[model samples]
Target: MLERIGITNFKAFACQDVDLAAFTLLTGLNSSGKSTVLQSLALLRQSHEAGLLDEADESGGFLLNGELVRLGTGQDVRHESYTEEDPDITLAVVKDEIRYAWRARYGREDDLLGLLEAPSGPTSWATRDLPSLFGHGFQYLKADRIVPDVSYPRSHDAAVRRSFLGARGEHTVNFLRAHQDDTITAKSLQLPEMPSTSLREATDYWMQRLCPGVNIETVGIHGTDTVRLSYGFGSGVSASNRYRPTNVGFGLTYALPIVVACVAAQPGSLILLENPEAHLHPQGQTWLAYLAVAAVSAGAQIVLETHSDHVLNGLRLAVKDGRIPASATAVHFFRRNGQTAEVISPSMGPDGMLSDWPKGFFDEWENSLEQLLD
Candidate 1:
């Protein structure tokens, strides 16, 4: 698992280091640099996947626009307050007691920043020695996910060959259709209430938490390169006719990728989620947090970016109930301080109490209640 990430002269941060855990929660207001952290990691994965991180090749460097992220040129990613003395952009990550660092020379209009050869940098290490970010079992789901649609793209390379649900989760329907019956090896992620350990069963079990008695089915639209997702209510003879995705609520469709991601997580996997709580009700948001916690228990690392108090409280409840230990979780509250972004990490205790709650850290409810009481 990734223990820490260090950034220098990157977007929204002049220099900053953020500690990571098995399950990390990043909460902050709009544009306070929350997404920047995820983007930095995604950028690294994108670069390496495109054969740009080959330190031996001087032509290789960071790939700004790619499958995972679409960051602009160096001029767009470089911090505004970078010092002329050290203008190069650097990113480093520590995993399993090894530190991998990279420094890229800045170019105003260039999207592929060139790598600098340094004795201590990753340029000398082999591809196998690099961090696990470049390997399989990595999923990055952006905030803007799929909505209710008649059919979604069905790509054999993306859904079956790579087992990748697109960043926007556009390929989720096809992926589900291909692997619905595969057994979920992670015991912790399998709900006891469900009779089967298949991915389809587990997905339905979790989705039911958001909408009770809902069953899902995915099928390839004959003669077309697309997959259709339909939902039905009830069971056996009482079951309602299968309804197209367009007939269901938006929240159910929007939450499908997240549900599938957590259900299919394996040991040593890295899942980066952005606003899994979007379109979910308070209770459903809490249940989603529980699902993520279960994924962590199965040995996968989850880095969640959310703006829901229900999600936060669900994590606390999980810890309090012994579902997950306090030491395995980390919460960072972020906010802007002038031109740069700042982070405040609150420690979690065994009893699920937080060591500190910053001024704007999920206090809106209390602040409003006090005003109403007065």
Candidate 2:
């Protein structure tokens, strides 16, 4: 697992070091630079996979994005006016017993040269070795788009197993069906309470967890040359089942990726999700948090970016209920000033309690209540 991540001259972060746990929660207001942290890690992993740097690149010396490598510089690094004269990108990671760094500088020739320096400590795993580990080992879910349609063409040559769900989750069903025989899927399906009604059974169970009393069913129909998955929700006592994605509430479709991703992830994978609680009801948001905890227990590391206090509370409850160890989770809040962002980390104790709650944290609700009273 990644123990620590240090970044400089990357997007909104001038310099920041984040200590990571098995499950990490990032919370903050809009544009506070929380997303930058995740983006930096993604870029680092990409660079490593591409072999752009050497062992020496792991140190603090490399220039990043034309600005001197510093923590908390607010200038936009992606601007065209940015010059390589100031080194901009530098990052490091502590994995196992080794400390590795990657640094880069824009050359006079306008080419970027990055070095992946060797580990400074025990030679367990080299920094260059992380790409493959990070490449398939991590999956990121962005919030802007919901899953797209993945109807299979009637052609006889359609690929049997599609690549893992795309960033927008277009291939959600194909991905899940591809992993039906995996150990994780086998175990989850074996649960006695899990309805074995059909392929839709598991999906329905997941949907119900998000919205109580709601039932969902997915049906696959092959017409002449195409295959498609249709959703049906609510039966008898509840709201009528709907057929189209647009017909269901936004919360249901928006939360679908999170549910599908968690259930489909393999052991030892790191899942980075942005706003898994988006469009969710308070109860649904809490249930999503519970799902995240369950994912961690199944051996996947989850890093979530959220704006919901309910989600935070649910994580605390997960700890209290012994679903996850307090030490396994870390919560970081990002506060922005001018161009730079500051990070504050709150620890979760063994008793499932937060060690500190910063002032103004979750203040939106208070502000709204005050306005009403006034």
Candidate 3:
């Protein structure tokens, strides 16, 4: 697994190292550099998948535009006040204590940033396996995901071969349609209430947390290369009429990929989520946290970037409730200083309380309540 990530001359950060665990929560104010961290991992995965992360050739390097992330050219990714006279951007990851760093020379208008330096050695499973980033399973869900669409694109390579749900979750319906019957053997991820432990059944069991009695169905269009998704509610005596996604609420569709991603997670999967609490209510947001915890407990590594205090609280509750140990989880609160970004990670105790609460770290609620009561 990727134990830590080190960034230099990246967007909003000159230099930073973040520790990753079974479940890592990246939380902070808007634009404080939470998304940047996820983008870094996505950027590496995108480049590696294309076989561009090669040390043999200096021409090989970070591919800014790809399936996982489109990070633009050097001007867009380099830190505004980048250090060193060379102005090369560097990103490194520590996997099982081995550090792999890739330095890319800056190019003004080039999306493919050439490598200045790459890891050199006899190749083995350490670099070959790359447990968290490759092989096992990977999913990157951007904040702006698919909405209530009539039909979604069906890509066999993306959904079936690669098992990717797309950055915006555009291929989610097809992925679900293909893998619906797959059984989930993870004890932690299984929903006891559901009769079967199949992916489709597990998806419904978890999706209900966001919206009660909600069920989903994805069907392929007869002649077209598209699939349609519909929702139904079992709320009342009147059995829910099967309705198009447009008829149901937006939150259900918006949160579907996240739920599906977690439900379909394998033991060594790496799931990077951006605000899984997009459109859910307070209770639903907390439930989403529990779902993330369940994914981690199932043996996957999840790096979540969220702004919801409820998500934070839910993680703390998970630790306190003995669902996940404090050590298995890591929380980093980020903040900006002028043009550079900095992170302050308050450790989680066994009791689920943080070792320290940095200013503006999920304390807005208490701050606002005090003023209102005063």
Candidate 4:
């Protein structure tokens, strides 16, 4: 698991180190550098996947624009306050207690920033022992996910060969179509009320948390290169006719990728979620958090970026109920301090209470209540 991440001279940070846990929550104000942390990891993964981080490849560098992220040139990613003395960008990760660091030189118009030095490790970062970020079980779901559509792309390479759901979850429908019948081995991820552990059934069970009795269906159009997703209400003789994705509640289709990602996650899977609470109601957001917690209990690592107080409270409830241990979770509140961003981590106790609740750290409800009472 990735225990920590260190960023230097990167976007929104002159230098920052954020500790990670089995389930890490990144929350803060808009543009406060929450996404930057996720982008950094994606950038590294993109570079490594493109063969730019090969062990003996001297020309290896950071791939800025790729399937996972589209960060612009070096000037766009380099911190504005970087001093001339140390103008290079650096990213480091601590995985399994070993520190791996990389330094890249800045080029104003170059999207692929050149490497300035080899990684600070015994072997190159691209060896067979690469970080789990580059592993097959890694999934990065961006905030702007797929909307309700009649048909989604069908990519055999992406869905079957690579087991990828696409960075924006554009390939989720096809992935579901291909893997719907696959068994979910992790008991924690299995819905207790549902008898079958198949991915499709579990997805339906979880989606019911958002909209009760709603189920999903995915199939390939006979002559098309895309897959279609439809929703159905009820079951057996009382079942309603299947409805197209556009005909259902918008949140159902929008949250499908998240449900599939968590339900299908295996041991050692790494899921980086951006605003999993988007398009979800308060109750749904809390349930989504519970799903993520269950994924963690099944041995998957999740780094979630969210702006939902309900999601936060749901995680606390998970800890209190013994669904997951407090030590397995970490919450970081991020905010801008002048030109740079800062992070304040609050620890969780066994009873689901936080060690600290900094100003602007999901306390708006109380702040507003006090004003109203006055």
Q: Please, what is the TM-score per model?
A: 0.96, 0.77, 0.97, 0.97
Question: How many clashes show up per model?
Answer: 0, 30, 0, 0
Using lDDT as the yardstick, the better of models 2 and 4 is 4
TM accuracy, model 1: 0.96
Per-residue lDDT tens digits of candidate 3, residues 247-327?
A: 888898899999989989888899999999998899999999999999999888999999999999999999999999999
* Residue 324 in candidate 2, Cα distance off native in Å: 1.0
Q: In candidate 2, which residue ranges exceed 4 Å CA deviation? A: 48-86, 107-137, 147-163, 180-192, 196-200, 213-227, 234-242, 370-374
lDDT of 1 by residue, 1-374 (tens): 89998889999899999999999999989899899899988888888878777663578888899888998999999999999999999888888777778899999999999988422545425345543477777889999999999999999998888788989999999999999999988878888899999999999999999999999999999999998999999898999999998888899999999999889888878899999999988999999999999999998899999999999999999999999999999999999998899999999998899999999999999999999999
- Model 1: residues >4 Å from true position, as ranges? 117-127
Model 2 Cα shift for residue 248 (angstroms): 1.7
The lDDT of each candidate is: 0.90, 0.63, 0.90, 0.89
